[model samples]
Target: MPNNKIGGHYSQAYDEELQQAVDRLVDMGGLVLQQLRDSMAAFTTADVVLAKQVKKGDRQVNSFEVDIDEHCLDILARRQPAATDLRLVLSVLKSINDVERIGDQAKRIAKTLLKDEQGSRPSAEQLAELNGMSAKVQLMLQHALLAFQQIDADKALNVLREDKAIDDDYSRIMQQSLSAMMHDSQQISVSLQISNVAKALERVGDHSRNICQHAIFLSKGRNVAHLNDDELQQIVEKKRD
Candidate 1:
């Protein structure tokens, strides 16, 4: 009975079921995004309490993934969705896996903070660079979730393009951390921890990009995961025209 693009099923119950699954997926995305933010804050500020909270939150994120996966499987078995509905189900299934992995990456960062015994922190300049990189990837994750909620291919494409900047930031941070280790042997432990955090953040960016690719697939009904930026742009633009 709902008047929407995804509606029109002969059974109104089927329409509601699909919408509920989407709503749950969006809720899961919000929780994962918050986990990432909390983990970054804990790492940067050395807040043990927040870091512990992030670790505890990972369990909840995992639960959501399992629940959603079951719901999607139920839909597939019962509804046998076709066309756009099939794409929606498949995209949700793929995106939730990426979302769960993002949560794991956040947990990895939290563990790095908890395991660090060295009192030394990154230099102010390096911390600033890390903060900048964190903000970029956080924005990317947020936008990717929004794109999925709306099924907006253009927004998803933009999120996909931003991954390169995160990659560059990761490379620069690795170089700086290595240089610090070389200059002061005593700083090696802390530098290694910083490198690990950077690696986790880099992986978060990758998972966020994967979610965006799933969003594009949902909207366009085509897998853009392997397409380069230029190729993806052409496809999205062609859809617009």
Candidate 2:
């Protein structure tokens, strides 16, 4: 719905500016998601080269973010997209920061691989589990971006559910890696690297989940991300009343 080629500026109309801003953000989200996925691949395969590539790509994501940020402000200034439109555009602005941070986490993973001067890899078992965690985080990112573009609150909530699972997996992998380190001094350094990567991935999950929360809020006018199921139910009931 966004077009860069639409030579004319936004008139006193809403439709033109709104679609352009949304389009730029969707492009930005797609790029950020790819960075997260590639960074995860870097950890899973111990592909330092791929990790570097993902790291380099973060700059583009950042650039896209700045461009979109400017566009949102311009739209707000020029069109004053009101009510739901204003909320959606503002959420896009806020969520892009999370997306950029997700790229940052991926870059952190790449840095871990590079800093491990010894070039050690995680144990095969740990690698397997880390890969699984990566897969889920990827899904969360994918869903978060999809929900944003689709404006689907249900899909956004699904991304929130995936966040809990990611944290659980991260904790499980950290425990396993730590146990290995305790048993042998030689593994201490590499295990720490692996743990750090896992933590980065987990944070990526957190950011993606936060984006979903923003999407839900934008679409349905609710802040369900911080609330438990019970609190959410009460809020829903109060709204009905």
Candidate 3:
């Protein structure tokens, strides 16, 4: 396992910079989490005002990505970090991109809600699978961010495991939406909108899993993104001799 502590550099300033990068990243994660939560709430309640707010919040998330990228680049230029330190910077760089994309997915969900015509709300039965998927992806996102904050490979692996469930849920929702569309041609428009929201939630799960993969890379110094579940379990469980 990699070092959990981040501030043992001989250069005190270098240590501070690394810590600052982590702090900012955690802050960004928190914002994105709330963005997703609010977007889902807006969807469930058909709250146009909240959906509008979630859409507007995407700008701040984009700004966070740009700021974090600049900070990581500064570290790479000045510190030229190697080994674990290099992994830390590189993981932060990769993680921020996923976090920003998660934010974008949230914005897409919000946009789907906002675009619905008046009196075109989807019934709760139609939204059931979507609601389930929203909850799971939110939990996955929360755990993935926590894994990065704590540098816990086990937690990252758990997030990876949950990703397959999200994929399954997405497939189920698509099938249900298609069935609804086929049964009632008039339901096609509403079914299509629900499909869009489900797709956004699925993408959110994917982005969250990507963040977890970066966490694993940071902790293990191994890229586990393309690994099968069994292979990932083995890599994360193996101890250095």
Instruction: List model 1 lDDT by residue over 1-241, tens digit each.
Output: 2226567889989988888778888899899889988998998888999999999999999999999999999999999999999998898899899999999999998998898834777777777788899899889998998888888889999999899999999999899889988999988988888898889889989998888888888888778877898988887777533
Clashes of each: 0, 0, 0
Off by over 4 Å in 2: 1-13, 233-241
CA lDDT of each candidate? 0.87, 0.77, 0.88
TM-score list, all predictions = 0.94, 0.87, 0.95
CA RMSD of each candidate after superposition: 2.1, 3.8, 2.1
lDDT of 1 at 48: 92
Choose 2 or 3, whichever is better by lDDT.
Answer: 3
lDDT (C-alpha) at residue 32 in model 1: 89
lDDT of 3 by residue, 40-138 (tens): 888889899999999999999999999999999999998899998999899999999999998999999899888874647789887777888888999
- The stretch of ten residues in a row with the least summed lDDT in candidate 1 is 1-10
- 125 Cα displacement, candidate 3 (Å): 2.1
Q: By TM-score, rank the candidates, best first.
A: 3, 1, 2
Task: Indicate which candidate wins on lDDT.
Answer: 3
Cα error, residue 162 of model 3, in Å, equals 1.2
